[model samples]
Target: MKLAIVGGGSTYTPELIDGFARLRDILPIGEIALIDPAEQRLELIAGLARRILARQGSPARVTTSTSVTSGVDGADAVLLQLRIGGQSARHRDETWPLECGCVGQETVGAGGLAKALRTVPVVLDIAEQVRASNPAAWLIDFTNPVGIVTRALQDAGHRAIGLCNVAIGFQRKFAAHLGVEPERIRLEHVGLNHLTWERGVTLLDEPDGESGREVLPELLDRFGERVAQDVRMPLTLLESLGVVPSYYLRYYYQHDAVVRELGARPSRAEEVAALERQLLALYANPSLNTKPELLAQRGGAFYSEAAVQLIAALLGTDGRSRTQVVTTRNDGILPQLPDAAVIEAPATVDAKGVRPLPQRPLPPLFAGLVAHVASYEELAVRAAVAGGRARVFDALLAHPLIGQLDLADQLTDRLIAHNHGYLSWA
Candidate 1:
């Protein structure tokens, strides 16, 4: 099958290429078209992609293009991993919010709102081009603020499904702790993208004579310190919640502390900017065909596996039928949330498309936070599509992380001032 990566110039492309090489048996990729406006990065990434495929003895051809229409034409699937304004813009997103005494994060709170406003319009334009090129092709989004972006695509009548590696990363970690293969571990991963909790971890292939048991608590107890450290949450909090929260939750649960920490250090965007420079230098090395070890520090662990598995399931390329966690429309899977809201949960995937699995109502603790964030996301989408200063102000006001009216007003003005070039209506 022909697959195109929309932001193929990203440093993360090598990790994805490694997955395509390793999982060739399941997906059988024939061609990979790298689409990006950054020609230098595109050439570097495409070379590494070709080298990785060659090392695997796979015959998939690697091509590069700057035109979305040309690159995605006749492709079976398109993957969106683009950044609107690159790391420089992200640096602004991660820093400016601190002046308002809020956590400076790229995927939540004020910074996340900035990203959504800038990204949604560009993604929608790309989706339109993809539809013009090949209506049958699926758009797999791996962008930040995925829930909002995915809803925008689906609402605009695009065939899209959002993908994140958080669940898979958790599954792999839990599997390692249990001394079992990752496939045997099934996580009851629920909530909006980036904001989720692991309520249960069940063994899919329980050995004979072994009773079915929920392993999340045991896993937490045995490795609570390490888990807490990884997520930057207190061990006591995890124990109290009785559920392992995603690392992103740290921004919400410890907003003030996180703001202090952020203020003391360089923005994550700055760190990544330095890292990307080194990564590009490494990519330029002709001898370097395999994914570099430094790439792991860049995060998105297990992203390739997640993307490949999701695509294989969607295209019915993988012979086995199974359910996998993905980001898609609620469709009653979350009765408490709006039907048009996007959620990340386990869903059965096949040629017919994705079907979210039924989930029991979340407990009040989790439900309240999710509903609060969902409300903000709904308004964020509206502001992104029908841009206006008022819409943006309302979105910030609605966010639980930035709920105060005065702070919202200040943040709204700051966001527009910093991102006016990208926001046409502003």
Candidate 2:
């Protein structure tokens, strides 16, 4: 099989390459195309990718390309990981929202909306090209604002599924705490990308199946403090909810505190920019044939394993339907959400397609927030696909984080101003 990674120039690419090398038996690839406009970075990543593959004695050929059309041509799967405006733009995304007293996160609030507007159009265009080149190819999106981007892809009728590392990261962490293998812990993870919760932890053998032994309560009881620290939430809150919320929830559950925290520190974008410099320097080392330890701090922890597992299951190479947390069409899995809404939930993936598994009803505490965010996401996709200042405002106003008309108005202006260069309709 042939695979192509758009934005393969990213510092995160090496982590992915390392996974492919280690898990080749699960998802064999005859070739890999690293697509990016940053030719120098592409060369550096591609060189390291080749070395990583060689160290494993795998014959998967690594190639670099500056053109998405050519890079994805005839590829079995196309992975989208590109950043539209790079970290400099991310710095803006993570900074400007604070001025409005909102959490300035890359995948939440006004900043996330800005990223959606900038990313959706490009992703759609690339999807179209992929369709032209290989209609059967799976477009795996690892892009931010995943719910919005994946909605756009599916809306356009492209074969796409969105992947994020949060669910897998949690699974691994929970498994370690339980002194069990990661595969034995099946997370009852629900909600949209980044905004999800672990409702249960079932110790099971298969990736997707009936609940084995319900162990979430026990795990929470024993390791509540550790889990709380991982999610950056208070143990009291965890005790109240009976579920572990993603760290992103902190932006909502404690918006004012997050705003103050962000204001007091450098934007995460700035920190990542510095880390990328160090990572690139490491990548430049000819002797370096493996992903560096510093790359782990660069974030996207367990990304490689998640990607490999999902791709393997998607391609039917895993030899059975696999349940993995992915962002895909709702398809009635969550009655609270429309079928067309893209949600991050556990789904059975196979060569035929992805099917969201049945889920218990979410109580008002979770469902209300899910519905509210789903509404905002709908408007967010609209503002992204068919641009207008009013649409952007409506989406922001709909967001729980920016419900006030005045704040939404201010944020809309700031978003367009900061991202006008990337938004054609601005």
Highest-TM-score candidate: 2
**Per-residue C-alpha lDDT of model 1 across residues 1-426, encoded as one tens digit per residue:** 899999999999999999999999989999999999999889999999999999988889999999999999989999999889999889999999999998888889999999999999999999999998799999999998888899999999999999999999988988888898888788899999989999888875553122456788889889999888877799999999999999999888888999999999999999999999999999999998899999998989999998888889888896755678999999888888989989999998887899999998999999999999999999999999999999999999999988999999999999999999999987
For model 2, how does the per-residue alpha-carbon lDDT over 296-358 read when each residue is reduced to its tens digit? Answer: 898999888999988898888868778889999998989988999999998888888898889
* Clashes found in each candidate (C-alpha, N, C closer than 3 A): 0, 0
Which lDDT value does model 2 have at 61?
96
Q: Candidate 2: minimum summed lDDT over ten consecutive residues — where?
A: 203-212
Model 2 regions more than 4 Å off: 205-211
Which lDDT values do the candidates have, in the order given? 0.91, 0.92
Task: List clashing residue pairs in candidate 2.
Answer: none
Clashing pairs in 1: none
Instruction: Please give the lDDT score at residue 413 for candidate 2.
Output: 94
Listed per candidate, the RMSD to the true structure in angstroms reads 1.7, 1.1
